[model samples]
Target: MKNKIVAALLAFFLGIFGVHKFYLGENLGGILYLLFSWTFIPGFLAFFDFLGLLLMSDQAFNAKFNPGIPYSVLDGSRSAQDITVALSQLKKLYDQDAITAEEYEEKRRKLLNEL
Candidate 1:
């Protein structure tokens, strides 16, 4: 997960080169920032980014940078590791005939869809 403080710091310091953009997975933005750093446009934009980061809510930040990952997964309520283990166990049960084919497919689909 991307931390707001880290992003803000990078924007404030190395934003001329778009370090925060790279950190946030905006590779194209980062490259553009690097390309235009001499022009000072990226640095100007970075200042606004720093200000925006300061004003953004944690939930909004997560929704933007960490899409597709639920808070529960981050909090360990139900994680990808747990899901993977469950899938392996479910496959074993199915292979051993502990579950019928239809039941296995239904359960597998439900688990996979969560990922």
Candidate 2:
């Protein structure tokens, strides 16, 4: 919500520089906007982004804003011990048939990749 507010205010005042895009966590978009703003593209883009933020549904907003950052690792990436414990629990759940093989494999893959 705060990001949206910042984007709105930036759009109102500095839309030409695409500062609004940066506030919305769009680094690439912000860079593009910054580079081409003087050509009028970013001004038009910022106007649309502003309208989208105001009128778009939550699902769309989430889809757009989702960095997919894990809350579990917010304090810093979880230690290997933590991942090991989680993987062990998942193994037990799979063995008990509480979760499907596909789910188990998917989670295992994610955990391995984290290491």
Candidate 3:
């Protein structure tokens, strides 16, 4: 669970020494930044990285750093198969009288709109 604010701060403050790169688990990049810290190029690049981190959406950050979550959930998009399965489950609940007809219709529309 890498935090966007933390990464941005690290990049801005300690990025010349590749602290942000290390936080992001890019050892090679961190090492390279350390190697060239004397030139100050890494500092300038780290500034850009800081800006980029600040501009990036939280979901994009999560997708990049957090593993194991489905891409559909992260992006808020769903495939036809997902919608189909969800609709079927909803239909089963409706048949079982677990949900009212009005509820079923509303939920069904919401699921379909994800296409």
Candidate 4:
């Protein structure tokens, strides 16, 4: 949620620097966005990013779990380890292409239940 907010702001303001991509832990994606920003690509990409984030679920955000202050703020009422593990697994699966974006979200909600 926080990343999404930051991304929205960056997309609207400092998107050329790809601040939102960095915020999302997408360092490579951010760099790519930055490199092409001058070509007007980043701005266009930011629009899609904004839309994707808007369509993203709270559960999906929770599953990404980058940690820091936002982690506790979003769902501190739940166990941290449960969220951590879910985030880890999701990340692994994402890297492995074992699950689609839709599946990642559903599994995320299930993992949150463990918390």
The number of the candidate with the highest lDDT is: 1
Q: What's the number of clashes in each of the models? A: 0, 0, 0, 0
* TM-scores for candidates 1 onward, in order: 0.64, 0.48, 0.60, 0.54
Worst 10 residues of 1 by lDDT: 69-78
* Model 4 Cα shift for residue 81 (angstroms): 11
Q: List the residue pairs that clash in candidate 3.
A: none
The true-versus-predicted C-alpha distance at residue 23 of model 1, in Å, is 0.4
The TM-score between candidate 2 and the true structure equals: 0.48
Higher-TM-score candidate of 2 and 3: 3
User: Lowest-lDDT window of 10 residues in candidate 3?
Assistant: 66-75
Tens digits of per-residue lDDT for model 4 on 40-59?
88887787777777777766
- Mind giving the per-residue lDDT tens digits that candidate 3 earns over 1-115? 5778999999999999999999988889999999999999999999999999999988788878766666676557888987898899999999999999999999999998888
- Segments in model 1 whose C-alpha atoms lie over 4 Å from true places: 73-115
Q: Spell out the clash pairs found in candidate 2.
A: none
Our tally of clashes for model 4 stands at 0
lDDT of 1: 0.91
Q: What's the alpha carbon RMSD for model 2?
A: 11.3
Collision pairs in model 1: none
The TM-score measured for candidate 3 stands at: 0.60
